[model samples]
Each structure stands twice: as structure tokens, then as C-alpha cells.
Target: MERNTTRRWARLGAVLGTGALLVGVLAGCSGAAPGADSGSTDTDAALKEDVTLTWWTWSDTTQEQADAISKAYPNVTFDVVKLENPDAVVTKLQNAIKAGKGAPDIVPVEYQTLPQLTLGDALADLAPYGLDEYEDAFTASTWNSVNVQDQLVAMPSDSGPMVMIYNKALYEKAGITEAPTTWDEFAVASAAIHAADPEAYIANSGDAGFFTSMIWASGGQPFKTDGENITIDLQDEGTKKFSDFWGARLEAGELSGLSTWSDEWTKALTQDKLGTLLMGSWMISGMDDYGPAGRFQVAPMPTWDGEPASAENGGSGLAVTSQSENKAAAAGILKYLADGEGRALLNQNGFPSTIADLENPEWLDHPYESYGGQPANQIGAASSASVIPGWQYLPYQGYANNVFSDSVGKALGSGGDLNEALVEWQDTLVQFGNEQGFTVNK
Candidate 1:
């Protein structure tokens, strides 16, 4: 799951190349320099090169994936630097680039932040290196994430398809036989659960990221661009439908007004004071840690009707920095790391839905007590494919999300004018984008 509470997504904005201020204290990114004798040839002589590559990551991914990649290239050694802070990673990377020294050969950037990171041009475009050959190897959403203006910015690593997890006991207590298939049904369930137990809610009030996911699920295209000019449609029908639904629920006291991932919310979840949690695939493991054993069940997110659609929540990929001396070697490691075997190894720490692994028979085998032995990974796999297409993010999406939270998030809990709040958030984003040398659209 998350490295920490805020670090999980707050650093989603970390990809921006803002802040010219250079901090002398760089986060640790250590490894030995490459020796001589490395070659593209498969000859034994190439083994003598022993290229050591540094990778900076906040996710505590095990070394198995790195080790597997090392076997693919005997001359390559991976020095994995697993940090806990995502913001520090962004700072160290930018500062290193500014100073022209001390950046890691490879770094992980979330898909949500890739568009923002592209503005800096610090990531190497792998299209020139023939990375397009593997273009169809990953899913469409993942493949799309790696490309910005036809440039392959990074290799797709893992995916986090948005879904809902419910407290099984709580749902049963409220007479919910199956997961709510539609939003109307969900609302009915929410009302029933709260009426039966006034202390409980169907779900808690989440932040901008969660709202963005719901917007995507409703097929709302919030952010997009046509080369130079950006088009941001925050007040779309889908968004209005989503917000109005939640707004009414919040007013009726059927939904918890507490912020997601907060201590109060977590307590509610553990104590069965909440009914369901609308979140991403990574939350599978997270829910286990927060709730008592055998109390939760995974299900596809409730839809407007019965159509399958979702939003990508938290996913990351590895990008070779433009500053890396061993760009070719770094790309090789990244490519090897995203393959089937590498993905399996990576999935040990984080859920993966890469092209090869998504359909693997083993995906349906991993059982969680929280899911009551259900193949939750399979549910995540299916949701990954159902994500709404053309759902793009602004280059300054992190700043926009922050602004949305500051304005709209505060309004959501108190049954304030959510539509007005969104308008304010949109205006703030337009201003930010225009100031950052972009043509803003609304």
C-alpha cells in the first residue's frame, strides 16, 4: 500500500519541476559506478562490465524483482534505494537535475503525475530507443500512461483499478445480500444501513482523489489537451450526477462526513461503524490492516446503471532519467522488471495488472481473510480493463487536487454547495495552469 498517509498521494504533485531552490541535503540514492567491458553482445566478455544501477523507490517492493532482472543481464547490478517519503524523492530528483549531479539512474513516477513530469523533460523519451516495440505488451490505459505527445516517458509497472470494499458483517446486518450493482441501489443500501444503525454509514467522505475516481467512473472527461490549449470540463453531467448524489447522502446523514484515511474513519471502519470503502486495488492489503479479520469483501464499484467502468487510482512506472549515463542499461533493467516474471515478483509487495499477469491463472488463487477467501485480485484485474477511456489529468493535477481539497473537500462534509466549490476549484486550476506557461481551457 501507501508508504505513509499523505506520502501515498500528496507526492502525486511531486512530479512537477517547480521550486528552483536547491536543497544541499539530497535524499540518499547510492550505488557503485559502472566498470568497463559492458556490451550489447551476449559474449562472456560483457559480464566483466558489471554495471551497477541505482533505483529510487518509496514503495517497499522486495528485491526479488530486482534479482530476477539481474539474472536477465548478468552484467547489471541493481542498487535499490527504498525510501519512505515520495515528496523527498521528487525534491532529490529535481535538485539533482538542477545541480547537474547525483540523480538516480531510474526513478518511479506515478501515472497521475507523468503528464506533469513531462513538462520538465527530465525523463528520457524511450521511443528513440525502440521502446515502441513493446507498445502493445501492456494494457491500453497503462500504455497510454507511458506516452505523452507520442513520447514514451516510462515503462508501465503496476496498476490500481478503483473498486469498493465493504464490511461483510455490516452489509449482512443491513440485509445487503449482494454488492450494490448500481448507484441507486447503493444509495438505497446506504439509507438502509444508516437507518438500521444510525452510527454507521455506507462510506466515508473522501478527498479530491476519490471524487476524481468517481467522476471517471461516471464517464466524465475532466481534463484534456489539444497539443497547446487545455480543456478542463469539471462541471460535466457525470460530475454533477456524482456530486449531487453524494451531496444528498451527506445531508441525509447516510454517508459519514469524516475524511478518508483519518483516525476517526479508520476507527469507524475497524469498529464496523462504516459499511463500505470506495478505494483502489492497493486498498485490498490496506483494508486487512485496518479492519478485523474476515469482516470485509471486495466488489466492483457501484455504477450508474450496470455498465462496467472505473478510474485508475494509484499506479506507478519506472522512467530512465535524461541525466543517467547508463541510459541504455537502465532501460534494459526497467524493461526486464516489467515482464511476466518480474511482475509476479513485484506483485508480492504491490498488486500488479500488467498484460501478462492480469490473465494469469494464479491471479484467482491468492485469498485474503478480509475478502473471505475470494479472489480479490481477479476482481481488480477485471476492473483494470473497465476503466473509462479518455480520462486525462492536467499537468498540474496535483496542485489542482490540492486546491480542490482546500475548496471543495471542505464543502463536501458540511453539505455546502459542491457545484460552487467545483467551479472555484476549476478557476484555481485555470489560473495555476496559465501562470505555469500553459494555455488553460474551461
Candidate 2:
């Protein structure tokens, strides 16, 4: 089945802003039509073919998982290429697509960057491969993130449903017995924790992605897109609620101003100077690297009104390139990784995205020695299920993130007014969107 090369190239040009000029040039140079696979609807026959696939990813695909994928599809060989980071993968993928060559057959794309890639029609649509049948397998928010403009462009790999990881020792020292259920309680605990140890704080602030996740958990629709028409409202009720609550605490020095993942931040974690971490479920795997495992405990994200609410922080999906000559083989590999035995192997090292894993009694109740033998997955599962629906990221979210440091980041670092910084961020996005030929509304 050969996909429409002309249409793919034209969409690529639209993303590159070279219009039909680049389209005509690439169409002529693309050689054989892309996705010229046998187009067999039979999955068994596709898996039997001897095909080699290049998988570009920033995360590790363990040898154990590789061996399992190999045994499942003996004829399929994978060339796993590890990149420096997610941004590197995105940059390389865009350049390869624009050049009409050198793109890998498979890539793990972050959920935030999925729309940016799909805008150029660079990934193969998986709906034809029976991927739509698994719609019920994932939560609505996780499923929606991988589907862009009604196209199932990627397979749900792993998700980052939000959770609160707190230092039990610090909470005990602050005279707090349990995790705060409401934002107001969290604020009070923050003050107590900081007062208990002048060098310690409840959490760190000032990362763009973290800020967006907080707004998302608070039920903010700050960014929404419908094709080329987008609505930007950083001043929504959710955004205001988050800004006002966190801003006051930040100004009072109840939260650390340290940037996340920085040397100082890691040091704070190692020394137990950081009391709590409001992060994604994926943070569970790395907790032991910073401090003793039994010292930390997982809890549901605190809510505005003492109700269950959550949002995704980081997650990615496996996507097949539209330019691949082995689309069927690539999709077969995706199916195995996303929904087959390979999924269980991957879940051993990360959080699960599928409902089967999230709801499994055994998986949810599995205890971790790091959290003092607590079943941390229970909290993660509840958070994933409670994620607010209708949350969306901009198609050009990469650009939005790059500009956040100058606007909102500065305010957060200085303990300035987050609400005003959000307005500035929204205005910048509006101007950039309109310049990109989008119908942007504020």
C-alpha cells in the first residue's frame, strides 16, 4: 500500500513554510513512492517477512524486551538508535522528513511533540492497522493525546499521570501525618515544612512543563486547537486558581526557587532538603537514585476543592514514519510493543498507559520497598483515571516552551505575579500563532 507522497510532501512544505516549491522538488527526488509496502491486511503474513526497522528513541529498550520482540517476530530485525534527548529526536525527524530521506521507520515521540509532527503528516496513520479497536484500552486523556486531528498517528506507549511524591521523614518532621488532600492544606504544609528547616521547602518551582501540568490538573483550558484555529486563554479559572495559590506560597518562600533537574535541585533531593515532589508517575523509577527508598511515599495530587483531579506531565508513543518502505512491518512492531508481551516488559521499567495494566489488581497493589512497602501504583492508577478531559497542547508547543523561560519562568524565579506572567505568555503565543498563519483567539 503506497501512501499519497504528493500530499505528504505538500504537508511537509506547509510545516517548513516553503510552500509548493519544496513540495515539487521533494516529490521528484523521493524516488520510489514512500510506504510502498505489500499493504497486506494480514498481520501474520507481515510479521513473517524479513524486514529491518530503525527505531529512534531517547529511552532505553532493554535487551530483555528486544529479545521478546525478536522472538515474537523472528523475521524482523531492529536497529535501535539511542539519541541524546527528546528534542534531538524531534529535530532529526523534522530534518529527515523535510529532506525526504534518512528518517527512521519507528520513533518514540513525546505526547507534547506528537501534534507538531502530525501537523506535517510525517507519521503513518495506524487506524488502518486495527489500532482503533484498542480505543477502549486506554484512558480518554491518554488516548486523545496520541490521536491528532482524528488520525491515529501513534501507539500509546507510556504515560505520566501526575502524582505527589513526598519525603515521609520531612512530613513527619513538619508534624504532618498524611499527604494534603486540598491545595489549601498543601499550602499550610508547605509553610510548616519550610519553617521546620530553613534550608528545606515543600517543592521546587519554575519549569514551563511543570507549570502547564499544574494548570492542567486544575482544569485549565489554556491551550486548545482545532486545525488552524486555536484558542489561548492562560487567564482561565483554573489557571487563575493555580497562579494565585502557588504565587502566594512562592512569594512567602514556602517553595524553593531552584530549577528542576538542576545540580542544586538534585543535591536538595539527595540531602532530603526537598520535602515533596509534585511530579509524574514516571518519577517512581528514579526515586532511589536520590535518597533512600523507604523515606519517600506516593500520594494523589492535591486538588483545588478536595476532589480528585490530575494531568499528564510526560509520556510518549511509538510512531511509524510515513516515508518508510515497510509500513506494515513497522506497524506490526508497534502493535507488539504497545499491546502485546512487549508492553508488560516495558511496564516493568515505567508506568502503564493501558487500562488493563492500570486496573489490574496485581499491578495496582504491587508494593515498592522504596516507599516503605507501599503500593504506589494505586495512587498512580487513581491519578491516571482522574485526569481532567479536554486538555490540549499547542501544535507548536516546542516553540511555546522555548519562549516560556523568558516570560513565566522569570516571574516564577523572582516570586513575582504568576497571573500577570501568564497573560504575557498568552499574548506572546497569540502573536506567534497569528504570524504562523493560524486563526488564534485569546
Candidate 3:
């Protein structure tokens, strides 16, 4: 119940710019650079206008956030629409963007979906409204995810820094007292755990997205584009080496062939048959809620070469849509959401991205019954700090992601030689790019 509830909140709206009709909507950013717009709009000037902006978000608390915003700028009225299904939100957004009308003033977007919403520049650029001023204000990677192709496209509301969540009781029963610090050590431990109890395994078989995180942790850049020149590399040393390790173990039964989040995985996790889960920090609340409690421990994810590294996962952002006739009002609302009362509302549900909030007692001091009273915020902050940068998602990541899932079975889907599957995934992406009219580079 807790996992489903929190995940719902995390899937809400984000920022980015768009269209020719959008040219009229964003009159201030007209003829602006494809990247950041001119940083000269007066946010206060926009706030004075009588505007009733619509916000499309997934959380039920959005109405509460809208109420706060309405109070902050009394002249600005906000209409908050709560959609229970994330796919429906994205579907409405897509329909609006394509028809060139009906899009909300602001909407919640997952960071991974920014490139899509902002495709052909359909969302409003926040830089002109002073969003870049807070560039140093958010965790670098989370901020980077919002800035598609060097432009401030969305305001990051929350982030999911990756970490290793292990069942402490399971480890103790397997005679392992410490979490592995390196992949070499991790593999050894995986073998030992399986040997100790044949029913136990380290992790699920996972999918392409899962491998993408692991690739990021290992310093691999799977997808990158320079305006027109796109580069695709899934067969990098790190990916190849990591795939080799896991593929061998999976075949040997050291690691479970179970898929993540499935009924099998949930039972294994609750029963302590699955020892460790390397995932985004958002999983902490789920672990605490679903598990027996006081039986979990978090550590920076194990590194490939023992270098300081980790990956990130599920995070959502907010953006101004092309439908808004009031850019100033929309930008103000986004800024307020990121740093104002909306931030508080966001914190009520998921992890925070505000720099000062990291240490603010109001944030860092939450000692909930979860984790047996450990200050989970500190652990979250530390995990976020360990993230290695330079990983980027392509503009067509959503399309490519689906294709990769079908082609490679996500992460070694149905199991053959995972390395060969990587090559196939690589070729498929390159082909998809060419078909989509991108100049595919090696």
C-alpha cells in the first residue's frame, strides 16, 4: 500500500518547451535559442496578471499544492487535475501536444519523458525565467536530467538516487556480515549465499533499464546526441564485463532468474530469499512497509572497479506546456513548486532535490518508524552524493527503450548470450535512429 501510494506521487508533472503555436504562447521566448531562452522575463510582472493556470499532475495532494499556489499569488488561480493512471496523464499530454491545443499550463513529467514532451521544443524554457539560477541548487545529475541538450527544460521536484538495499537478516543467516563494496566481492557473496541456501539469490534478471543503471554506475554512456549527431554504445567495456559476470552467475543459479517486481520477487524479498536489491532510494519506504522492519540496511551500490560510483532511478519533474498563454505565471508556478510551498507538498510524498533542504532539519531529521528510526534522509543524501555523472538519455529514449525491450528482452530477456543480445540492442537502436531521421554515428 505504501509503495503504490508513494510511487503515485513520484510520477507527477515536469518542465520543457515546444511548437509554432507555442511561439505565440511563449511570446517572450520567441526566436530564442533552441536551448536556454533569454533570461530577462520578470516573474513578479507575470504574477500580477489575473491568470487561472491548469496543472496536470498524478498525486492526490496536487489539489493541496494548487491551494497553496493560489494563496501565494492571489491573482493566479490554479486548476489541479488528479489522474490516477500515469499512462493516462502521458496520453492526454501526447494528444494535446499533437493536436496543438488542450495541454495544461503545467504538467508532471518523469525525467525520462522530458526529451519526448520537449521534442521539437513543445514545452516552455525556464532559463529565461531564472531556472538556471538554481542549477547549482539541485543535485547535479537530477538537474542535468531536466536540462535536455544544455537547456533548462524542466524543474526537478524529486530524485531517486540509487543504492543497495539488502535484507540484514538474510545476510546474517548466510554468514555474511558486511555488504560487498566491489563487484568481485559481490559475486563471491552471491555464490556463498546460494551455496548456504539454494533458495537464496542476490538479484533479479532485470531488464534494459536495469542494465542502463548498471552501465551508468560503471561509467558507460549508452545513448548520447549532439543536436544532429547521435552515438549509440551498448557494447562498452563496462556493460560487456558486467553482462558477462551476471550472465554466468544467472546460468549457474547463483543469481535468481526471477524478474523484478513480479509476484515471485515480492515473495522472495518478503521471505528473505532474495538477499539484496540495488535500486533507487524510493524503494526504502517500500522495503520498510513490506518487510518485517528493522531487517534492512543501505549502502552505496557496489562499484565495478571499487571506484566511488552509483546510479539513479525513478524521478519526476514539472514543466510549462505550450498551451499556456501566460509564460510568466507558468514559470512562477514552476519556481514556486521547486522551492516554495510545492516543495513542502512534494516532500510530503517523495525524496527532495532542493540543495538547502538536504541539511534543513525539517528535511534531514525525519526519523520515522521506517528503518527502525534511522534518519533515512541522511542515507538518501549520501547515496545521491555517490552518483557518477555523464550518463544521458536520448531524445527518442522512450521509443528506443520499448524497442530495446522487445529486441534484447529488456535485460537478457528469455536468456541467450547476453553479450550478443547487447550487440543486437545496439544495432536495433542505430537502425531505429536512422529510420527516425537522426544522423546515426558509431
Measured by TM-score, the strongest candidate is 2
lDDT of 3 by residue, 151-188 (tens): 78889988888888887777777788898899888888
- Model 1 segments beyond 4 Å from truth? 1-48, 62-64, 71-74
lDDT of 2 by residue, 1-442 (tens): 1468888987887877875678787676764345566666555567788888888878775445666788877898888888989999999998888777888888889899988888866898899987778888777888999999999999888899999999988888999989999988898889999998999999998588899999999998899899999999999999998999889988898888888989999999888799888888999766878777699999999998888999999988889888887888888777776665777877877788989988899988888888878999999989998999988999999889999988888888887888898999999999999998999993
Alpha-carbon TM-score of each model against the true structure: 0.85, 0.91, 0.85
Clash counts for all predictions: 0, 1, 25
- The TM-score of candidate 1 is 0.85
Q: Name model 2 segments beyond 4 Å from true.
A: 1-42, 62-64
lDDT of each: 0.76, 0.86, 0.76
> What's the CA RMSD for each of the models?
10.9, 7.8, 11.9
Error of 2 at 158 (Å): 0.9
Worst 10 residues of 1 by lDDT: 28-37
